[model samples]
Every structure is written in structure tokens, then in C-alpha cells.
Target: MSPVAAPAAGPSATPSADRVADVRALSDHLPRFFRLVQALKQAAGVDGRDRAALVLLFPLVRVGPLRQSALAELVHADPSTVSRHVAALVEQGLVQRVADETDGRATRLLVTDAGRAAAERLREERTAHLAAVTAGWSDDDLAVLTELFGRLLDDLTAALPADSRPAFPAPREKP
Candidate 1:
């Protein structure tokens, strides 16, 4: 089997022209990646929730309870849109509303046991799908892809303004 080709040099390693091309390539590819993942999720049955609702469940599962406003910011969605998603999730018994421990007047959304189960199933299905797709990939290639993607996510998160950043746990430091 042929080895996978390395990605083009990124901004730090490339000339300005190459960097611009690389950035443009990334911009062009991200939407395709998003659509592919969305399609995969849809095929995985997504627990009967719409994509937006399932997306909201992820942050809640990963980061624990959050205020609706905070969840909206984390998902980079409008508060009203998130509110609608939350309402649907709540109605499905996948999410619950709880009073904020720190604020008497405020409420937070928590995932239900059923929600956690669904999230776990979704994760497993996605992992299986990815594994099947990459079944021919070598371990080193998979490692490199995982490392680069994690770095990209960390860099993107860091580039956001401090106040605009999500309330999720901080990225881990490389040893």
C-alpha cells in the first residue's frame, strides 16, 4: 500500500505565499469535514435529536452543567437557538434544568443519565465509523493526524478573546 502524503507545511514552517495557500486550503477543507461528520452523525441515528441538539449535548457531557447562555457561547450559537435546542433536549428527557449552586436566581442545564448513555453510544459509533474509514492507516499516520488536529483545536481556542472563550476545561500542556 502507498504511504499517506504529509500535509503541506503550515504557517510556522512555510514562506508567506505557502502559508496563505495553506490557510486557504484549511478554510476550504473545514466545511467539507464538518459536513462529513454531520452526515456520519445522522447515519448513526443521533438518538432522535437534531444535529444542533446533539451538538449541545456534547459540551454538557464533556464539561458538565452550564448555563444556557454559556452553552450557547461554547457552541458558538445564538442564545435563542440554544434555548430551543435545550427545550427539545429537556422535553426528550435527555437534559434537565437545575438551579445554579452559586446563583440563586440562575439555572443550569445538566445532562440526564439517559443523555450520558446516548452520548456514549454516539461516541462509540463515531469511533467505530472513523476506525472503519481509517482501517488501512498506519499507527504513525493516525498518531500524526491526532496530534495535529488536537494542536489545531488548541490554537483556535487560544486565539479566541479571553471573555469569548468557552468555559470548558483548559487544554492539557504537552509534556
Candidate 2:
């Protein structure tokens, strides 16, 4: 019998000058943008002790209770990695795991009263910060800024490579 042929390697992707220019523009704003997010997180009392905890808890506050696997998917982290965060939250009395009715072996995570309180604090801090930062702007301008920033994030995330550790799922079909 003839030997089977090996799969061909894909072409190497390289960015052109235009792409470089686009990247440079983004790079120029990245430091300030990240610093702002860091400052906000710090103001909300998210420290080293709760870095991963904040990541896990923030989404829960926004989206409500979720299966451990689903939470992992939302965070773009492995199940084991998410489990560790959940464990920590549970130990701190901030999150509780309840057995799924349909599947006893499966569990859904719910934020406890303490978790809700913490999440509220974070939300308030963010709202106050945004309000203060945009104090000089009109309501219409603030609305436009919010809409545009979300759109920009969507566009940039869609443009990212698959290997990138996305904060959420990509807008594409999974293989």
C-alpha cells in the first residue's frame, strides 16, 4: 500500500505596514486604558488576595448564577482554574455551590449575600468613576462614548487571533 501524505503546513501570517500602524495606534492608548482599569479595580478593593476572585465574581454579578463549566467558558479559563477560584470564594463565604436538579453530580454557582455586597461596591465605584471622569461631557456625549467603546471592543476582539486569551467567547462558530 502507498504511504499516506502528510498534511500541508499553513502559510505564515504577517502584518503589513497598515496593520503595524493600526497596532501602534492601539498601543499608544493601551497603557492609559489599562491603568484606568487597574485604578478602578483597586478602588473597588480588588487586591492580590482576590484577583482571580474578582474575575470570577464580576461576571456572576452581571449574568447571575451559572454552571461551573459555563463560568469557565465565560472567563476563558479551564475548568480546573475556575474551580480554584470558586473554592476560594466558597471558603470566604462569598459563593455557594448548589447541586443541579437535573444532574445531581453537576453544580451551579451562586453568589452569596456577601458576594452581592462586594459586587455592589465594585459597581458603585465604577459608576462613580465614570460619572466623575465624564463630568465635563454632556449626557449625549457620554452615551456616544459608551456605545463607541463597546463597539470598539467588539471589533478589536473579533480581530484578535484564536490563541489570544479572550475575556469572552469569540463571535464565530466553534470547530
Top-lDDT structure, candidate number: 1
- For candidate 1, write residues 1-175 as lDDT tens digits: 2233465586467555655676788899999999987776667665535766866788998888999998888878888888988998899899999999999999999999999887787668777878898899998887878777887888898998998777785444453
**Worst 10-residue stretch by lDDT in candidate 1?**
1-10
| Model 2 misplacement above 4 A | 1-24, 39-45, 160-175
Each prediction's total of clashing residue pairs, residues at least 3 apart in sequence or on different chains, is: 0, 0
Tens digit of per-residue lDDT, candidate 2, span 10-44 = 33656556656765877888899999877766676
Clashes of 1: 0
Best by TM-score: 1
- TM-score of each model, paired residue for residue: 0.76, 0.65
Candidate 1 collision pairs: none
Task: Give the TM-score comparing model 2 with the true structure, all chains together.
Answer: 0.65
TM-score (C-alpha) between model 1 and the true structure = 0.76
Q: What's the residue-level lDDT of 142 in candidate 2?
A: 72
lDDT assessment of candidate 2? 0.74
Residue 77 miss distance in model 1 (angstroms):
1.2
